[model samples]
Target chain A: MRILVVDDMVTMRKIIKTQLTKLGYTDITEADDGTTAVEAIKIAVSSGQPYDLIISDWNMPNMSGLDLLKAIKSTAEIANTPFLMVTAEAEQKSIIEAIKSGVSNYIVKPFTPDTLQEKIKKIIPNPVK
Target chain B: MPIKVPKTLHPFINAVEKTFKILCFLDVTPGDPIIKNHKVSDKSISGIVGMVGSKYIGSFVISFTAECILNIVQKMLGEKYTEVNDAVSDTVAEITNIVFGNAKKELADMNITLEMAIPYTIRGNNHIITHKTDGPYVVIPFSSSLGTFTIEMGMEPKKKDRRG
Candidate 1:
């Protein structure tokens, strides 16, 4: 499945990309922050190359992952895009907010690759296998 | 439930170990903590995050030498960083966020609620990060294949009279 991994930290984006690649998916793109992620999503959606899923980190420097999710969900062109949020913060209020914002899944930092795969499967069943 | 004052930096240490193991694929074992000045060298990177809640108020900092930080960044990002630059320092900040975020989640599981602020990054040689709390900062030294780093925590019980 085509995926977009967004995080201000290149380390984090790399880690997610590596894990996704391990899961048998190679069509992955990246964005450093929410603003760029929005643009990438728009461009992809406009070109009929929309991503199957988005994995974004919360608490980035500029706009956050939540903001990107909201932006995508608000746009009719990409509103159906599935989103997964990754965050170091475990605040229940923020998790609730992401849920309310319509995130397809949520994973906290320090999570195992198996857990990540499970979340991916739930979001996009049998993703790349 | 009542708030319990922390007497050790174990939570922060565990947070560090857990974070690096998962994110960088390194198993970090922290050495015994030492109470020392919260100063860092000019060629070091520090990730700082403030902790505030009804139970506790303070900050968490992670310090890394230029060589040490570049090593981990390369491991995590797969890029060679010769010096501590603006781009590579984001690793320290995310490490700070993960350490503090994990600790706060652990505390919340036991009914202690704490709030975290945005993590700030500091770079330079021989610069000092002043702790909001008193002296004798709890500095827990840790080592990995890359190099050595320290996790400093300054914590204090919240004033009883304050309410938010």
Candidate 2:
């Protein structure tokens, strides 16, 4: 039930967190950039409170979402954590790269709560009902 | 050879229109996109994200004037922002992200998948963006109550030999 949401924009992070909360996810954490997201993930794993899922933005200072996703997948402890990339870039090349990098799912920007709910259901192990 | 315009252009236009209405609260009408024969300012209040795909490799830019940015930020926050502060600058970046993100979904329906790069803002005047490659550049212009903004697309279909 623990999830991590990463993005540089404060408003966007807030909006996505709000949506996740509405979807009944209570154990959520936020990171502003890729570096922070990575650090947070590492700390969580070591502390035995590993995140169940990660939803990250593409562009960020220091490290990007793709880099963060790659980092997560490479680590043995949290490699299988369901990771979703939420970004504004919808070019075919980026999509292919994300797939190659092993993203669990991908969603574009300005998406509705319903779209998010559907995507999460597909990836999350169990429904919150 | 006549270049094929990706079918995603229409939905991209629709998404742009919707974003303007929701974020800027301005009614927008799409006009014919013009490719300026002369150099345009690269130093405007613009947000840009790079798009890489099987068919294209280039950047998408959303250009606005200082005045236009101020107006939109003020509306978005429901407060009067006379100048570009941190909040206003962040707002501008978020606005472009939303516009591009929405367009990506519409494009996906046509099997044209894309991923968003990080969104960055260009500050200054008379900034020039040159495309050394031989792909089609699309410049879309929109008119709104606050002012006019341009969505400049400089994507060339990816060549087979080039590594993505």
Candidate 3:
């Protein structure tokens, strides 16, 4: 499965990539911010290999994950793709906004790989094992 | 004017412990806290974040010796890091962001609501930190098998109370 991980912090991107790799995922790509993530998603869709999943951080410099989620959901082609928000913003308001915006799952940062695996499974019943 | 510190700093303390345990897979014990003027040594790095609320305003800081940070990052990423680099700095900022986020939730339970802000990373020998509040930066030190680090929190109630 092709997965896109978006986070402004390089360390966080690496960590998420590492965790996804450990979960038997090899086709992973990364974007530093929401703007770049949007470009990547569009390019991937045009190339006929749209991402299977998008995991993004909530707070970013260019565009926030919530904005990115809204953008994706509004676009007909990529709207169906499952989105998982990984963030440090655990506020009820933030979570509610993400849910209202159509995030498949939300996980707070500093989470374990087991927790990630569980969340991923909920979104993708048989994520590329 | 005397600055009134918050009644509890357990949120930040608990957040740091949980972050280290889950993210780095290392157990950490917080040392006794000190008020104001904690010494940051040479070759140290810190991640600073400003927080604001209806009732108060302040900042949260996490400081580490370069050696300690390098060791922790190496352990976290399963790679060898001899010196602090962009990667190391990014780790510190993200860790601070997570800790602050966690702490904000707990603080909210105590009727303290903090707005989120991105963290900043400063690295050098004895870099200075300026918090939002005027007085009383509470510094809590933590020790792990890798090394030692400190977290400083300072918040003073706003001059005029406003309900959110």
For candidate 2, the C-alpha RMSD (Å) to the true structure equals 5.6
**Cα TM-score per model:** 0.86, 0.68, 0.94
TM-score of chain B, candidate 1? Answer: 0.87
Candidate 2: residue B105 lDDT (0-100)? 68
**iRMSD, all candidates:** 2.0, 3.4, 0.8
Candidate 2 chain B lowest-lDDT run of ten: B35-44
Tell me the spans in candidate 2 whose CA falls farther than 4 Å from its real position.
A21-27, A60-62, A89-101, A125-129, B1-15, B18-27, B40-44, B49-59, B66-81, B94-119, B124-139, B145-147, B153-164
lDDT of 3 by residue, A37-114 (tens): 888999999999999999999988769999999999998988898999998977898899999999999999889888
Docking class of 2: acceptable
- Candidate 3, residues B8-102, lDDT tens digits: the string is 58988889899988988889998776777543434489999999888888889999987789888988887778888888898999999999999
Candidate 3 CA-lDDT value: 0.87
Per-residue alpha-carbon lDDT of candidate 2 for residues A4-118, written as tens digits (9 for 90 to 100) = 9998897677667877877888888999988888889889999998888899988677888899999988989879888989877666677899999999999877666678888
lDDT of each: 0.81, 0.74, 0.87
Candidate 1: give the clashing pairs.
Answer: B41-B125, B41-B126, B42-B124, B42-B125, B42-B126, B43-B125
Alpha carbon lDDT at A81, candidate 1: 94
- Which candidate comes out best when scored by lDDT? 3
Candidate 1 has a TM-score of 0.86
Q: Considering DockQ, where higher is better, how would the candidates rank from best to worst?
A: 3, 1, 2
Quickly count the clashes in candidate 2.
17
